[model samples]
Target: MDPHPPPPPQPPNNPVFPPQTPNGPTIALRPQMRPTSTLRPQTFAGSATLGMCRMKEWWLQVGLLGVPLLAVYLHIPPPQLSPALRSWKSSGSFFTYKDLNIFYRDSSGAVGSSDIVVLLHGFPTSSYDWSKIWEGLTQRFHRVIALDFLGFGFSDKPRPHGYSIFEQATIVEGLLRHLGLRHQRINLLSHDYGDTVAQELLHRYEHNKTGSILINSLCLSNGGIFPETHYPRSIQKLLKDGGLLSPIILRLMNFFFFSGGLGAVFGPYTQPSQAEYWDMWTAVQNNDGNLVMDSILQYINQRKKHRERWVGALMSTSVPLHLIYGPLDPVNPHPEFLQFYKKVLPMSTVSVLDDHISHYPQLEDPTGFLNAYLNFINSF
Candidate 1:
């Protein structure tokens, strides 16, 4: 496994508009401006028609004339990674709750008797990502559920619909109630985007009609906590804005992502380890704008910056909280942010793995990550 991380996203050097051909694609050069009160573009058709003449003609142009691109960013879909086997690596029962298909692996020891571990994966990866730690912890806990979040894993993906983090949280809550895992506080272990969905679930847990469970403890690794922290790379930023250069970039990504070779080029950008990370990276490469959707909700919707709200939720609960971080990944919340947690949370602990555990510590350093998890659960 190569230790060096992938190169950062190259600066977008293309012009906002392409050269227009007589019969080629339209080359409208419109600078993307997200709502601002700054000076407006000069209107050449002018005020001459506004007061002096009655305009009887109406003009409807293509999807991209001066028409402002009104977009509702949704969640990124996970790479459609094929399950290694229909049979479990470490097997469990199958169940469903309101459109989400869940696979529950029964724990081997007392960890299964009184408590449970519910794990979640973020964008591009499925519950399959948890197989490593799940294998290690399943024996000790009462039950270990690595659920396939809607639109991720082998779960369903509906078109033209939204994938908001809030929506995914609801589905997970319903699954818990449907599984009869209620009245017992459960430990939550989440990664990447999974961390956000977990926060929403815990915050809204009090109002849960089923009153199924409480977040006994929080174990987060490599999640997008603050947007400015893992701020969008140049490639991601340009694509989201639908710049004229977007279509080309999208096609380029599709080519590399769908290809088998060094498609893993961007894999280490998150937390470089082995080039194999790109295998999972390209799984959801075509998950229908799941990344863009996630970015919008995360960056634009205030969902991503809810660190205070998440910490506040932890404070409100008597549950013990712990953070197992991959210190090598600079973007994954620093120890300072943990101070905000300490300001309000008294029963919280922080551990950092200075190994190859970048964002996905579970995958990077499974042993250390699992130890931190089991220790936190035991503390409660």
Candidate 2:
């Protein structure tokens, strides 16, 4: 008891093992092995099938939600024309060009001067763009005219048709012809997309193409005339090259997107008012004009393809040529564009506005723009 203990007694010789069956090996039914539930073990193939079913269900749910949302967006009605826009439309009249109704405004002003100035507006916008400089122009010239290209402004926007700078130039010529001013010499004031159309018109005039307007002088402002120097915004690039996504984007384009994109080109201090933005949106919305933006944006490509034709027209023309540039324009930024322009067209004159001024110079600085243009016009 004090030092060591006796060894424990041994049991009788009998092994503690499960009884075996006569025909098979003994099976130990441990708690884990005992069939607790009816659920079967999942095989690899079954797991894969379940995953596939879940994926299909997820995609179906997404389709169910996205389809209706897209429908609602596509069916959103165009905004009604604001009173200002309505007045703009009421003042202007439509001229027919091969069954398409083109909107235009012709104002007879300044009895003393016989000179006529025709304005060609940029893309996604219309003649209303010239409204800022309209009265100023009319005061100096005897007549002022501006027109919405076939797919712009209050004009009819036809789908499934190719829209090109060439066609826009033709439309300008047709407008003049409709107004009985085809033979009259016209001073051209163009901007952005209009600049390309002006270039095409200038080409026709220089080549003596029939039905071309007689250009007395051409003044361009903040336009993408040189595709090399021009930089289109990301949205523009996407829309132009979007292909299948274009229609969807066009349908989804609302006032916010339009205004935000358009506002970016303007000088920080010269952004358009909300009402002005609404007017612009209304014009784009009218006649489902938004749908044609991608088609119209193809002009960017056209400019690259026909760079020689357009830029060459500017370089070779005998008519007085001038450029009123907004130095801060992102589309055609300063120094590079200006340097190249002077290099290309040494004979042409240029008027560089303030450093703060960006694209839409006329709207940003109408007085400066008008003075610059008038000075050019007076010099000749």
Candidate 3:
């Protein structure tokens, strides 16, 4: 197969917006200002009436001025893409899927290797999450492919769209076909949300439910594989609840919360620098992504709903399986979920990145993650 195939056709540029519109009149909900001083009664008989009239006029003036400012604030332009994202886009390209644009990176690996590794990233993050390991994999494997799932990263975030793992799997398959890899053997590497997509694909491939894609091996990093044993973030729970307060919760998200939340997922020893944090936040804010946080979070619900099908996929696949875990992962603690993987797949290779490496092993300790991956895939 030719490693440098022609780039896939790009999709038309469009914007991402929240599925459900905000309730009530957007312009009328402006906050009222407090008076600086009490209005003294005038010497005239109608002084009280005059004072009340003055108060009403003052409010009108404030609203007129504030309305324009509010419009500018609400119309926040798309954030500048981070350097990682920009370079990744420059080296890669996009393809159309059901009228949505999906971003993907397909880099040719070292010569003479028949392996094709597909990287699947987790939630609230884009394919950029694989930046640390992409180059390393390309140097060793024959081909490395990664994509931002719809509703995440550079992919089109469409509200009111089906954000199911099964849909996500189909998109992956479509990309594979677009890149001419449908009948080729694939080695799967995924983390967090990507893990679920991998499981569904395996389930389908094992049952001959999918196209010509053949699985050679699989490596799963930290994710909520066993939904029952998982502990999702508080905001995720609120979003999953689908309550009236969901809008407020999403609106309240800012750089501090987003960055701090990312930090918290790391081991105590590993802290992402401000620059790294800002890059991630920039990606999230691109195309007003903050608005669809609640909608994309529906993946948690999908995990719960399809737990059996996904888990069965994990255990029943005939190909070799491996698990690379960070024991201190706050959201998907290793103790709770690792045991399940071990019990189901007793013979699968399991590598524990000890020393409190948290959920993102590739980011926190890239060398260790890469070595483990190389050993696992190369062993067989």
Q: How does model 1 score by TM-score?
A: 0.63
Q: Relative to the unseen true structure, what is the C-alpha lDDT of residue 194 in candidate 2, on a scale of 0 to 100?
A: 95
Across 193-247, the per-residue lDDT of candidate 1 in tens digits comes to 7877777777776445354357777777666654445543334455556645654
Candidate 3 residues 1-380, lDDT tens each? 99889866543332332122345432333333446323333345377678889999999999999989867767667668767668877888899999899989999989998889999999788888888988899999999999988887778888665578888989999999999998999999999999999999999888898473688988999988888768988868887686677766666677888887778888888777787787788878776777787877888988888888998887777799998988899887757677877877787889999767998999999889999999998898
Writing each residue's lDDT as its tens digit, candidate 2 over 113-217 gives: 989999999877889998888989888999999999988989999997799999989989998998899889999999999999999999999999999989999
Give the alpha-carbon lDDT of every model: 0.59, 0.91, 0.83
Residues forming the 10-long window of minimal summed lDDT in candidate 3? 12-21
Ranking by TM-score: 2, 3, 1
Query: Which candidate number would show the highest TM-score if scored against the true structure?
Result: 2
33 Cα displacement, candidate 1 (Å): 56
Sorted on lDDT, highest at the top, how do the candidates line up?
Answer: 2, 3, 1
- Once model 1 is optimally superposed onto the true structure by TM-score, how far is the C-alpha of residue 236 displaced, in angstroms? 4.1
- Who wins the lDDT comparison? 2
**TM-score of each candidate?**
0.63, 0.86, 0.82
Off by over 4 Å in 3: 1-70
